[model samples]
Target: MSTLQVRVARKVSEADGISSFELVAADGAQLPAFEAGAHIDVHLRDGLLRQYSLCNPPQERHRYLIAVLRDPSSRGGSTAMHDEIEAGHLITISAPKNHFPLEPAARSLLFAGGIGVTPILAMAEALAGAGADFEMHYSARTPERAAFLQRIAAAPYAACVHVHYDSGDAAQKLDCAAVLGAPRADTHIYVCGPGGYIDHVLGAAKALGWPAAQVHREYFSAAPVDEAGDTAFDVKLASSGQVFTIPPGRTVVEVLAEHGIDIPVSCEQGVCGTCLTRVTGGVPDHRDVYLTDEERAANDQFTPCCSRSKSAVLSLDL
Candidate 1:
């Protein structure tokens, strides 16, 4: 992965307490190339690494734009990104990665919940450029807390976009069925949101007989960390030729980083899929909500954070 030392060049706060940060390379170098629906891992002052989607269009050459919602209960990633990071300060970040890529389809339906709009905004712009049939369903707690509501409302397909405010009225709560009804064979439903929101949309779509392949989702919250409540396991790094024992209370990510193995990681909770590594051996318990059954069956990749090995010793590609 390419590591870039980025300098915060500008900062702005929009409605709904969302803070947008514009970052440029510290040395005034051109930023790494990235596509829509891509995200980068940011290393914060507190040693916490977090992932933020690149919302700005690729046409913006001078800087990369990222929006952060100050999660009050956060472990300080967003809080620090919003409060401490300022213009001229340098920060380390991983190159942009895209696991939630937009697939080719005749038409598309995009769903964004709260801060989840970051990636979907870029997707909408790309769809517009391609002249594809697409609509965006943006839902939030209230109109006041919705970030970029105005900007999104002014997009090319703004008339097709649907905004739902949970506190407004029952009808305002996102009607997944109405928006997703009778999906065309080539229609792809893309969703990114809080765990509950993603689950609701996916579940409802599945119940409506939409094929699993037609639905794509990105999760903002990590899955349950305590798989089986408590179990210690062993992890073997193939390249390093070393073994590490994960204690019951600690996770694979904590142990690996502690050993200075330097596997790229963000959202240490395991939902972001940032610490994903190829599995050389061992059946992963597959606790994460990110991977599909087919992906878990392949056993080629596993997130080191919440997922553990069913076998006594797990071997990793990394």
Candidate 2:
């Protein structure tokens, strides 16, 4: 959990297969600060870490922008950034982390699909540089894959950007019930894509009543797993009471890193609560979109790299 070499300043091609890059700070220095729904964890070659978001405009300190989407069914970090990343090289990332932030509502509604428009295009440029009040809606599967759509159609809050498609025409695609049916006690929606477009925009913003803390999301992965209903549990480990054995297809962070216990994961697909931990006893099985549902009915905490255990013995706090 250290990294930060950076330097890849600008790669561009933001569309069909996505791309974008930008980085910076290899020697120019000034980086370590970020906000609008952050994320950074590149670190590729072999270990393949991957978590990309942070699409420029958290008051841009020199660079950072991300994007990527080449995943033609990728299991190898978007095919190693579309075949060995290039522009200026460097790489090794991790530093800007945010389990999809940008809270404090009273106006906001982003939602993005396809490349999940990288952190809702940095929360619509930090809610249009803090003048607050937002809109976005994006969706894509046409409009040439929509990654940034002409820089969100020339941004300066480009009239709160809208764009939907899937080849467009059904009253301009994306409806989620005419933009999230009707929940607005002062807005707040967020969402990021893929798992069926964050389950149809949080199930139409929870069938249009919205609140569950105003509906936020991020999940660029994790929701497929079902190794025939995985079970095998047992963890323990309250700082060295070490038990282990988590094997119905391994996880509990790979059985606590096979005993030596690593525990520094980053988006091992539980959507970056970065291996959350701190459970006190069993009942976890919450497959993570990073908690909530009253933090999974207050089970204390879970997500040992993709959560498990409904009580064959969990107990972590290690």
Best of the candidates, TM-score: 1
Off by over 4 Å in 2: 1-10, 13-43, 53-84, 87-108, 111-134, 137-150, 154-157, 162-188, 191-210, 219-289, 293-295, 298-301, 306-318
Candidate 2, 47-160: lDDT as tens digits:
888889888898878889898888777889987887789899998897898878888887988888889888888888888988998888888878877877777778789888
**Candidate 1 TM-score over all chains jointly:** 0.89
Error of 1 at 11 (Å): 1.6
Candidate 1 local lDDT, 211-282, one digit each (tens): 989899888776445444667779988988799998877778889888887776668676777678899988
Candidate 1 displacement at residue 281 in angstroms: 3.8
Candidate 1's C-alpha runs over 4 A off are 27-29, 236-244, 256-262
Q: Please report, in order, the local distance difference test score of every candidate based on alpha carbons.
A: 0.84, 0.83
Best by lDDT: 1
